[model samples]
Target: MSLAAETREAVRARPFLRDALRAGLVNHSAAATWLAERAGLDGDSDAIAAALRRFREDLPAYETDPRAASVTMRSGVGVVDDASDGDGNRAGESLLLRVGDAAVVDGGDRTAILATGDVDVAALANALGRLAAADVDIAAAGVAGDALVCVVSRRDGANAVRVVEAALDAVPVDEN
Candidate 1:
């Protein structure tokens, strides 16, 4: 049978295997072994082995598209100050800045362009500019702390990957 067909059959034979696969606990072979061990069955290794091979073959279909991946950064600083309360009690004040997810989408896909991280506004703008220069469509953008979040999209798959890569590269590396 074809790999897809074999995978479907394997899933049908053992529904719990789906959870195991999704959880990343084991591949098809280990899942089959687990099932066999639980059922106290022996000499069924061949069947399980075949099913695992088919599942492995079909894994590429479920893999994330590299072109769709994005990069993001989150960085920030904090400050504390001493203060006096109305009751004459000592108190402290705190301030913080956090950068959320920055991403690139095709038009308005909403998928992040990069993993989230803290980045500076200048670096973020430079990245955005680079993406725009490459003709990557930007849906939205925001800046938090030293980080910038940008959404970029492109009609071509290759272009999307290029844009995301360029934007990520524009982020400045910390020397300290």
Candidate 2:
């Protein structure tokens, strides 16, 4: 089977894998390592690389400003066509907040950072503040395993890395 076909088959067999890959939260190397570990098979770096490349290329095009903040779902009262609930509450149903679908977001010229170590929230907040201070807009951020994955504007990727490194350095190391 072709690499693309194999990738699609693998993901189709495991929906969670597709969700994870589509989320764009995990790095290709990390995903490959995980797949190898999960399948109890030897790591095939070449196959992993091709699979990831094909998956990315298959994603839909969604052009957006790298500096623009990602879309966030806001919860509010939404009208329901059917009154499933006997009470009038059905007409005023509460909506749940959800994160934007990463597949619909532009990945071009975006930098993905996967930092593994002590992921201190305070340090992360500080790093975010520093980015804000520098006007480096954060597109998306999520915690994947021991690493914090963040997507930011490519133009500010280098600066973001430097700022995060400095922030991490400034954090006090606990002597345990």
Candidate 3:
């Protein structure tokens, strides 16, 4: 394809680049040079810069939509391999989730932050990003239907809950 097409594809493949372009926060010439090396685009730097300029015009402005969700924290959660001596099948302390061989069971060393109500993958993604920025290490995380859950160390539970709530309040959405 043309250099313009290639540049567009490269930017779309990198969300940060796309966001920068949409916000008009990047220098076209510098971005072109970076893209040439990063995306292996073979073209004159000036031409690639021109392409980036054009591509930026085509992308929609960046925006965020608040997700209506309630966040809650639950302690004593842990992840285990469901196949381990059938311990994951224990009664009373119910299982939060089981994926493949791994299962998040109740009553463990970790804490779980659960967000329900109009929550989806995007909300979860935003929450995860905020959690990472806050230096909270996630043990297990998932979003299905209206439920979004993140398992983290017990010490980080309170901070993770706040980050998740804030992230859900302004989940990013890029319109095309």
lDDT of 2: 0.51
Q: How well is each residue in 42-123 modelled by candidate 2, as lDDT tens digits?
A: 4385676567667866754322111211222221122223434444333343322113322212214566544566664545
Give the distance in Å from residue 31's predicted Cα in candidate 2 to where it truly belongs: 49
Q: Who wins the lDDT comparison?
A: 3
Off by over 4 Å in 1: 1-110, 154-158, 170-176
lDDT for 58 in candidate 2 is 70
RMSD of candidate 2 to true structure, Å = 17.5
- Worst window of 10 by summed lDDT in candidate 2: 63-72
Model 2 quality (TM-score): 0.37
User: What's the TM-score of each model vs. the native?
Assistant: 0.30, 0.37, 0.89
Could you give the C-alpha RMSD of every candidate to the true structure, in order shown?
16.5, 17.5, 2.2
In candidate 3, list every pair of residues with a backbone clash: 76-108
**Candidate 2 collision pairs:** none
- Give the top-scoring candidate (TM-score): 3
